[model samples]
Target chain A: MESMEADILIVGGGAAGFACALEAAERGATVLVLEKQPETGGSSAMSGGCLAFAGTEMQREQGIEDSAELLANDLKQLGGTDADPALIAAFATHQLETYDWLKAHGQVFSPALEASSGQSVPRVHTVDPADMVRLLAARCRTTGKVTLLVETAARRLQHDPAAHRVTGVLAEGRDGPIDIRARNGVVLASGGFSRNPDLVRQFAPDCEHAVFVGGAGNVGDGLRMAWALGADLRDMAQIKGTFGKHPTDELNNHSCLCVYKGAIAVNQDGRRFVDESLSYKLLGAACLRQPYGAAFQILDEPILRSGDNEVRILDFERRLEEGLFIQADTLEGLARQIEVPEEMLTKTVADYNAYVDSGEDREFGRKHLVHNHGALRRIETAPFYAYPSTAAVYGTYCGLRVDPAMHVIDVFGERIEGLLAAGEVVGGFHGNAYMTGSALGKALVFGRIAARTALGAAAG
Target chain B: MQVVVLLAGVVDPKWRLDRLGLRPGTELADESGLPRRLSPFDEAALETALKLRDADPAVRVTAVLPGDVGSDALLRGVAAFRPDRAFRFDTSGLAPWDPRAAVRLLGLAVGAACGCPDLVLMGREFGDCDDGVLPAALAEAQGWRFCGLAHAVAIADGRFVAHRIRGPREELLRLPPPALVSITNDRGNRLRHPLMKNVMLAKRGPVEVVTPQAGAIPRAVVARSLAVVPPPQRGAGACRILSGPVDAQVAELAAYLRARRQAAAP
Candidate 1:
């Protein structure tokens, strides 16, 4: 029953928690960060590290004309009709500052802007997100005011019912149970509930069948804590769905074989369902339209030999040997192995071959009409690969309801005193669908906001 | 051409003896305070060292363990890999400093023990701290070229060529003499387990135990050492097998793949 004390207790040492700790410590407050995992990066470290921001110093210097309004509108449109206007506005306004802060922290960014999911403009900025976390960690270590407790999981929040203030947290570390008392406030920067099947089923039932591609540590601890404290939840139906033929055996490894280049995906009924030319996110959603949200990517020998054969082909072959991929010599045989209907699979490939001969995908309107008549070689090629594609849930968009100031609110819309949330733990930021750089951007922006708001409340 | 691997034994808190339903007394505890297996990354390092040594008879492999006598079992486990030599240094009363201090001390000790070997290989990051800065720090302390997260390594022209995952892309870099490498378990590289013969040989081999030097004390001190507790076990959902018409499924998968690629693309 050891006890520790800090001015602010930030839970989850991912991008958001670290960002909040950095801001609070830099503002002259004693902060303590608790990470459930041994590493501080969380899923942020394993990500592609793309940061989306409009009108950044880099972008502005390059004469890329953009504004918060434009970005906000784009996000809202991209998220469809269900997006929250207030959250979008807040995220857009603060996104530039997030980018600027990262740049100031020595995060190297590529000057080249690329397109991301749901963005009309090429506003996606790429950087090593792990490096960014490392930089923040290094800074946090030097801050002197910030104490990091890794391999510590915050289980519950201690609240003063009379004052309606969250005074501390209950956590378990290597030693044992620890009571962390926070004088200022508590910030929950823990990530989404993708790994929690129950929560996923409750929130995103359509995507409950998706496989997880990220860390094993994302079990919705933050969301559960907030829910226990009567935090109002929103956008419970949203998810960041990943569409890839992820091998169940190599779930922990990042060994993804790009089947898009040379293979055609088929459903259980042996037919193409959606336009293969659409984005991967849309394709992931389309997979959910199937029976179990699963499909298989079929590839031939010629497609495997194409491109950087050593880099791409050998990597896939290695995975195949590791039993991460399912291979068969014939279309019927491949379907039988994965339990798909053999007769239907044969007919489906024949139809796809016919379409390939005509250089047209009438049903889905695929645009990459490179007449690879050779690619249409009957699925009779030896060692035909069939990677079962499943929905891998990266993160849930559902989280605690928050105001523009990033303060968590109760079900009745009353702000929870001394309790704040940021990152994927806060809802309405992403709406129905997620954009690529939005997670990192939202973490940085709302993390700073939560710290500032907590500081203000503490001062009062 | 002997490859000397500095195998530091770390406690694996995840591995439990299934038959006994308990852990052996000699097992090292992980941050969760549970009996765990050996560090997977360190095992990978040992595997790489052994592979390099086996590739050429001239290459000899040695293992080093820096801890108290309590770490003998762990050292024995590493020695089972049939290293040319194994040494256990006295780690008593040493203050746990930052990686910089640990690397400095270990580099000096290793230099003295092996007289500056051709190349030094270790895990990119230990599970305990996982800062991934130790090997680089050690290399910097010894004024040697260093590479982190090396997925593949090949020796050419008496220099080590390493393929590393740097950010998004993989880079092939060549380091000249006296290089230090921190190996990361990437997707392709797999570590092999020791055979029965190697294990028996390791059991019979002599493990040289060295006491601490006179007036030896670590320059750094651990402010506090905290145990890491394992989180509650999560319930895995039932596997839902997708079954239906093949054409419809392919159509559905294609759309999903395209959208995901579009989302992930730079």
Candidate 2:
């Protein structure tokens, strides 16, 4: 076995791992990032690239009123009693600085902000997810203090029993077994277990039929490794699929959230089920309960024209070009195309339009487009469209329990010294429902915090 | 029966190649740091070989890949399929653009990595650099019978049979031992996922490395320069929707169709 040493050993080279490495290197600490896949960016690259941040210059420049308090309050309101308030507070505290840190380190965000899920207002700052990871990885390499080894998978954590601390990691490199010692600590940021069917079945059996799409390397490596050491898990039962993925589209991993852009979701019976203004996570559960576990987002030319190509979920025209959206000149034609009753669909459209005019939704009581943002619009434009949608488990959004500093907590609620975690691997952040962009947001926030805590512990 | 599969992984097609250029002072394309996976054709060839092994317990399969350190992961991925032997031959200082030289080196690597085999398999294009020519060129140079675009391979009457499609027609060609088949991707030959246990074992196991003796072979062709060009833009016209009652819209659409037909009539 070949042995090496670094100040901090970060597992999984996605957003969290790269963020940790970049932060550690900037602080003059030697970091080694091990990525199991051939590529560095894991599920973070495949993500929709929205980061939820509050009180940022981008939001202020757009004249959108937002603050960290509002962001935290919204998270708790959506999360209900299951959310960990400490973790939410930690996120709200560091989110602004992290946003500045990313922008200072060359992370580019689009000018447009989208309102989805739990946002009180539009706060999603978007970037090309792959480019963001690549940028961080490149910066890490340039620091001369971070060594990133792709194709090296961390197999087991080396623990010092006498010291009660994690000392190193046993990894399998391209050549053979490699024993790498971390002088400071080890950060587990290996993403979620959506790709692991057995784990998904055990945790979320109802989500078995949901399409599994994420980083191919995410097979619960971090969660399982941490579980071996008696790490207490959090929010595992709250694992719900995200709505709006085209179940049969294999070429593209992105999901079209037409509902967020003023489209109404209709079941196979051509009737609206849910309010369509709730969190997509809640909508996902409702969608799964529908016939064939599928629904169609019905919209019009005006709603379709409101899409922004820069945002992956709102890229309606691109999906149109891919032939994923069914378009017709009339509701009757759309009803025939999507195989719904013409009279029911026409009546449904008429009813929805009447609700928009009367300022009241009698059926589902949908008052806004998505979450409390964007007024409801009448779906009466000339060209009508239908996007076939189903739920997809993009991330498990649940994993091991960790403190605000990202230290792994054991079943007994004691800190597992020198064992830290971040990213999707650390749960308790999103609680019962996920707000759009918060998963990626918490990954970046917690990753930098994990690095700081590790180095800060060593200094103390 | 001894079967050898020549696998050359390609850069993942899903990734956009922002930059493509030759390495400094070398004719080879600078592809370091780019992610690669087994191409569809390569997967078909390996799956075909696996199918043959599954049918006969006595059949021994060897998977050989020619690449640099970056390709080791691809070989490990093949090893997860649990072939009798899987190894990578050092492809440094070799130019894949030079077909004759590439064939010569590939032939030598195949011979050195695995002994004389009853059958050999490779992808249609061999690698991203070739234009569906290296497999046939190798067959011609080695005096072995060759079949191109084979979707599946099986033994029929003690001879290797290649199932392929040629010009929209399916054809099955039977060849004697020591024949080479260039496999093409198809639903029938889609690669199966390896067991997680086997994948873990393969990751931990040491990879077998082979360095083929690249003798001074004269190159018949030389690449002067290469340029990466973006694909042509496809401009889609805005959609025009015909509204109002059905009959009037149908009549207007029929008239437009008739005008187009008249304009197209020569």
Candidate 3:
């Protein structure tokens, strides 16, 4: 029954929420960010730290030609038809500016470029997501205008029907239930619903079997609140997963996808399945269809040597040390460790080796390591390794529908007046497929837009 | 009963070590950039504190973290566990081997927070080898009873009943109060998942930080430097390719592994 007030109230303190807080603070607005978790960073901290940007200096230095147009096209192609063209266009145009803003705000990006799941070029600019968030949170606190109330979870929005506005939000904190009035509007950047089992079973039942490795606090609180207000939804059926997660990995939630480093993925039958060059999401889809929904990334010593132990997708040796990898002197021995039929696995490796030698993959035609990059290598080393890989639902790609301006839109295509949203909670940004950096990118790009649009309207 | 809990987080063991580097002229490890988490042993000790608090409502627990601002995130994460009070005993300028100065600072911090705790709980190893010696030495310095390898500790008749696993047998030592016990990681003492509410509220809470004297202090030991090397590679060599039929290849690999194991046996 306590109360507080701010011009703009932000729900969730992940990348998107923090970005909004920083933006609103820059505009001289008194903003309050309510984070559900004790710590600020949500899934953003656990993310791969790659942001999708176009025409950056990093890209230029790497001699990789890229444009917003090409980037948007790739997003559209990957996201499928369900993706909102306007939102994709918005991400394309403003991504470079957001990148600059982040850098200008003490966020450091390593110049090294990496090619992730769906990136055409090495456009995935890397930043330590946790560090970036910590820096942002520190900056917000120092500003004095932005009050980040951690452990404060918003329960419901206060929508004034008479004024046709969202006045504030009611949240639970240390004291008890407290109401916070937002003079401008309320922005929901609370992220996705990947961690909610009931919600996952309802929306993405097919992928429910996959491990839930999302941020512990991401339970679709934003989606539920939006639904209560009649907000329309999009791409709900597009709840898929990323493929490198090890099912047995409890200590570390990372997956070493040696497959991208030219390892072949095999099913329980010990036969190669899909073309390993496809997007991990697509690979995950193929994996779910296999018997017992089991798959493994089988590799050899040469491929293992090529693994850059630092990178999750390439850390073959680390996984080997963790005993997550089964190394044997022969293919049959490797197969026995992973519990697959020895004979079938041996034949599969032999065929794959032949394919690599001839540079011709008759089954999957996977000539490249990942997405038209890197040459294929034969897995014929003395100690063959098999890393058990399972697809896990990381982030829910579908949720409340929103316009390019970051305003939550209802079923009738009308903006839920006074209700603005950002981050993974607002959908229609990603279509059917996900680009490597777009999830976090969308959160940043849209979070800023939401704040600017709300503040601009207030000034008007 | 008042309890002082000492907590220190280690760099996530699961993370690649390439991020660890020398801090140029400084003897300190460049830990500013890596992700840190509550070490298993730290969790065990914290769980011990919580269990003590839960068992007796009169028990008050305070957490003391010793580090620089680099540990703020970890400090906030620790706060979510709802410790009554948490203090960061700044160890920024102190040398690694200066247990004399370090213990003095810790004793001062503990006194400043809550005078003379009934129990002082900490992990057996304080992250690094040299620093791990502090807990045992601190117990002697404070003139408190010291116990080690207490996987679980419980209050029985106002005394500490510690479960220490010795070989295959379990020893139940009933130690008097005002003891310093170094907890080892045990499944029974895994820290429970803190509620999201407490997790949020802890960040806004104040962390009492105490700075040691700014003047350059003499140390019992001076570090020449530190070498951040990858752990020695295990079973390094070329893979021996066994060709021919599947059965022949399997038999050959099995025999090779057996022969290698026998040859290396002491």
Candidate 4:
């Protein structure tokens, strides 16, 4: 029956948790990060490493002009009216400053600006998420005020019903059970419930069939704990998977996103299905509704070569090296190699190529390569390639609801006292549709805000 | 009974090998930036020791890490498993390639951590570079009975019993205390996730870091070498699959290989 106390107890040592700990410790608060996994870095480490930030230095250097207003408009348009306008506005306002904040705290980003699933312009800045988490965790350790506890999972939030406050936590450790008193407040940055099949089945049943690709530690512990406190949840039914995950290749975390770079998606009947130009999250939903929930990314040689080998989802050449791509001299041969009907695939490609030549996607009307940019190309080449692709639940993208100040809101429409949240565990930022890189972005922006609020600082 | 497990392993082997780089001016690998985690066998040995601790009320599991001392992030990283006592026998921040050198250093480290431990457990290969060298060399140096490739180790009749896979069958052997056993990963002996509460508490105090005096180097007969192996060139040609039954496909594959081998028998 060991017990300890800290000024702040941050559950889940993920991108959000680590960022919160660093911010709180810098402000001279004793912060403790409890992670259930053997190591930290949650799903953030396994992500595609893209962060959506408007008006970034990388964007300007790359000669692409972007603004917060435009970025906010894209998110709202893509996410529909379901997304919290207040939260999206807050994110737009702080997105640029957060990018600078991360850089000021030893975070580095690649200069290359690449287009991802949903973006009007190239703004997805990349980083080695694992290295970034390691760097942040290293900084947290150096603070002498932050204690990181991996292999320690928070079981439940200790709520003082009379005081209407979450005072502490009941957690299980390496040895046995222990209680921790969060003197100031407890922050839940425990990530999403994508890894928990039961929770996924309960909330977003459509995602149940998607390959569960998420942080092993994310099993809805924070979600359940918050639910026990009557915390209102948001966007639960909107959990959509990331498209183009190699149906059988579970080892690699990143999915192949050739569809975003002018590749077409074909269903089991060797016919094109949904418009692949939409957000990948939307594509995942459309893909699942197809036959057997499986499809293939059919592209030309130029499109195959357009892949950036460094980034995971963008690295089509790596997948080619790994033998994930079925290459053939003719589309018929590729269709046969992938065990699909040759005639149907050949005709499908011919019609698509004709449409590409005519400058219009007649049937699906896929105008842009991704979202609304990058012109589509004709799939006419000697050596055609086809990759069997499906969808995977990368992150739940839904969880407890929180306010702009990062306070967890209850079902009664009141803020839960001494309870704050950040990361994938606190959702509603991405409503019905998810734009790539925004999950990590939201985690960072809200993580700092949560720390500032918990430390009694004015919400910046 | 005090049991000591070697809690060291190779860098996560799952990393894309294309990312690996070799240091210039030295044959050493540039794995300092790589993510290092407990190997499967390392977890197995640690799990086996925990099982022993559970089976016997008096048994205590201690960990002896014979690698980096400066890597407090990694050092305290493994200590979260909540061993009874754990410490590092500081090396040059890397495990030496010499088998005998690793043995001498590990022997001193074991002695320093737990005086005359009843059993010493280690992975089948320490960092893959050791290749069962550490356990064999240590047992030889200490003159203790050695057992290698044991998937499961248990205490029975006051003796250490090990069930090992030999060829296609399982073999069991029993040895007296003060035994050194090299363990391989087993389905049942996976390391359990440590509770979050204990992980925080276990790493509170400073990890006992000791720098053992360098042992005498043996007469050198071994010189290690390193080379990058290029992948075999795969012919970029049409792959034709024999559309038939399984037996027919196997026969065709066998005939093709036989014909190719005979044609190349120059």
TM-score of chain B of each: 0.72, 0.83, 0.81, 0.78
C-alpha lDDT of candidate 2 relative to the true structure: 0.88
Which predicted model would earn the best TM-score?
A: 2
Query: What are the DockQ scores of the candidates, in order?
Result: 0.02, 0.02, 0.01, 0.01
Tens digit per residue, CA lDDT, model 4, A227-248: 9999999998888878988775
Q: Give the lowest summed-lDDT range of ten residues in model 2 chain B.
A: B192-201
Q: Is the docking of candidate 1 incorrect, acceptable, medium or high quality?
A: incorrect
Runs in model 4 deviating more than 4 A are A457-460, B1-266
Instruction: Provide candidate 2's TM-score on chain A.
Output: 0.98
- Per-residue lDDT tens digits for candidate 3, residues A168-196, read 99999977999999999999999898888
Candidate 4: tens digits of C-alpha lDDT, residues B187-260? 77876554323344555768778787654434232334555779676676657767653335768999989998
Q: After aligning candidate 1 to the native by TM-score, how far in Å is the CA of A175 from where it should be?
A: 4.1
Clashing pairs in 4: A151-B196, A152-B196, A153-B196, A173-B195, A173-B196, A173-B197, A173-B198, A174-B195
Native-interface RMSD of candidate 2: 18.7
Model 2 bad stretches (over 4 Å) = B1-266
What is the C-alpha lDDT profile of model 2 across A1-460, one tens digit per residue?
8999999999999999999989989999999999888777899999999999999999999999999999999999889888999999999999999999999999889989988777879998999999999888889979999988878999999987777688989999999999999998999999999888889999999996688899999899999988988899999999888899886566779778889888999988899999988888988999998877788899999899999888998899988876678778999999876778999999999999999999999998898888778899999987999988888899999999999999999999988899999999998988889899999999899999999999999999
Off by over 4 Å in 1: A56-70, A110-113, A204-208, A249-264, A276-282, A288-292, A297-362, A365-388, B1-266
